[model samples]
Target: MKKFRKIGVAAVGVLTLTALVSGCGTANTTNSTPSSSAPVPTGNAGTTGKLEIFSWWTGVASSKALKALIHVFNEKYPHVQVINEAVAGGAGSNAHAVLASRMTNNNPPGTFQVHAGNGSLYSWVQAGDLDSLNNLYQSQGWLNKYPKSLLNLITFNGNIYAVPVDMQRANVLWYNPSIFKKYNLTPPTTFSQFFQDAKVLKAHGITPLALANHGNWETTLLFSDVLLGTVGYTDYNKLLHGQMSWNSPGVVQAANTFTKMMQYTNSDASALHWQQADQLVANGQAAMNVMGDWAQGYFKTTLNLTPGKDFGWAPTPGTQGVFSVVSDVFALPSKLSASQKAVALNFLKVLGSAEGQKVFNPLKGTFSPRLDANPSDYDAYSQAAMKSYQKDQLTLCIGQGAVNPGFTTAFENAMAIFVTNHNTKQFIQSIENAAQTNPLS
Candidate 1:
């Protein structure tokens, strides 16, 4: 959510924005070049070297999960040393900046964490900085192992560019069951019910929604959830694809709902990090929080809380049939030495393998990207998420990776403005301008 200068082409004119607002797809397409063939090295080709993997998983649960996965990788090839260059803050904002700088300077890591959609992955692809994984998928027979929707997110022009480690459900509404039971309330399934519950919770001196906006993406994330609830799946996807406008009536309503919902949130929300916000709900200081399932790892591993008893979860209001997804994936950089490439490919293999996913996601509070992953290996919460993922209408999450990075940054700035001013019209206008300046297509 740090204000970032727009980095992509700014060819989308105001007229294009207006047309998109009217639900016309007339904008120019910025298609990526199809990936060329690259030789797929078998059995690592006797590779023995250091593999530097970069990511923002420095938290206790995430770091431990990465280490566990690395341990598994080492067991397969003990000669390779894995350097986990994790930079953590602002839910990957700091890491992203560092990675961008590294990429700009031509000092890329062997593999780096990127969101699975058009945001980070497509930016790298458009810049011609990524190595296609199509050969890798073919060599490993992974074409049928993963869900087609997931593969489509990381693939472009018939080329796969990244290996997704795990899938996170971004539209979860987590609540303290004890507080809900005390109030004789059940999890709300609609925004009307949500507002009614918020009023009751506020009357009893409980913050209705726990929010941490110190990282501006959290604000954007909340708005994205509301937008999905307001516009539903089809239009939300259109919005992300630059076929719909930010200034549309649905977006205005979503922004208005976001502003109204903020009224019941903790006053100190802007000063807290996401973990602190989750703590507010965990300690029963707040009744509920809308976040990805990673909060389950914090509550379970860090806070030592039981899942079903200490906290409960439901889909965000009006989003029961939708799955807003955020996946952490590792993409190979175009620049790599032969040995580094071999080790990197091996590392990706580990990431995409069933054993790695089974060991990693259970501890990380997410589910495997693969459809064939063993459900019994995950916890009750993750099992439910995996089931929902299979059955729900999938949509890309903005903060996670659904749109272009330039557009994502612009939308974050709009959210920052909306959070301070609470002007719904201005908020809509700001995002419309953002879309005009930073077109996704």
Candidate 2:
């Protein structure tokens, strides 16, 4: 979540994306034409090198998914040794900082984890630090597999910078099904209903909403969803892309709505991490938690719970038909040695391949970015999310990787302050000042 491409008004056009439910066909690498200077091995003939895979995937589920992906890569290229350089932190906060230091010091990793879209990928491209993967996309037959909007996020100046492995929906309301059933409540679809549900649950001594803001991004993410819900998709896009003013009535209303919702959250939210907050819902101490689909991995894999049975999901209240997308992508540094570049690009090929997506997405609690990924490979909740992503109006998550780093930092700073104060007027003024100072492009 460092910084990436700019998905402004022009980039937002393709966000109303069509579903990526296509047939599962094999990926063909017949068109791969490696440059003479940096010769890429079409096959694993003499591939032997150390590939440092850098990411912030040290969590149980994510680490397993990373291993699975590496296993696949290793199977094809047995000679290449993979170095897992995973740093622990929520939202790549620490890893990206380390990565930035390494990159600036000309000690770039073979490939690094980056959120796709108007995030860190764009910043890298702007600084000429990343190599375009257009050739790899073509060779892997992935040009038409992903959504145009998704591809647009990683593309700058007609060149693609990253390979998105999976897509996470940020606008998900994860709830304890048994708790709801015991309370004779259903999943809320609108803010009013959510409040009513929260009130009922709170009356029964339950934490109505579980929130974690240890790094402050969680609250910002929640606010982003609230903004989308209050303003609707069109205006939401307008607001995030700088086309609409931050001081707009919709933004103020959204801020107010976010504040109201915060009343139902746990008092200890500031002290908890996301997983701890999620555990509250899982342990039945909390009724609901609004988080990204990655929570599914925790519930299913780590907690050994079943989707739809142990837990239930719906769009965050009033955010129905809107998919707030946050994708994890990998990119190669432009300055790697030719041999290192070859190995890194090979890893990228695997990352972008249909085989790689199918293998990694399910375990990671996300769906593949590829259109050709089979729905049967996923769970009940994922299937539903897949359908929603296909049909829903796709909006980017602000706290994730949807804007310039400067604007993102300002926006996050404003959110951190707003979460504590809950002053709507001050929040609006702060954000307006941020947008002006950072210039949201």
Clashes of each: 0, 8
Q: What TM-score does each of the candidates earn? A: 0.92, 0.90
Per residue, candidate 2 scores C-alpha lDDT tens digits across 306-395 of 998898998988888778889899988888887899899888888988898888989989888777778999999889988877766676
> What lDDT does the true structure give each of the candidates?
0.82, 0.81
> Which residue pairs show collisions in model 2?
3-119, 3-120, 4-119, 4-120, 4-121, 4-122, 5-118, 5-122
Question: Candidate 1: deviation at residue 403, Å?
Answer: 1.0
Q: Residue 289 of candidate 1: its Cα lDDT? A: 96
The clash tally of candidate 1 reads 0
lDDT of 2 at 246: 87
Question: Which tens-of-lDDT digit does each residue in 232-298 have in candidate 1?
Answer: 8878877877788877889888888888998999998889998899999999999999998899889
Model 1 RMSD vs true structure:
7.9
Question: Which residues of candidate 2, in runs, are more than 4 Å off?
Answer: 1-40, 43-46
| Cα lDDT, model 2, residue 348 | 85
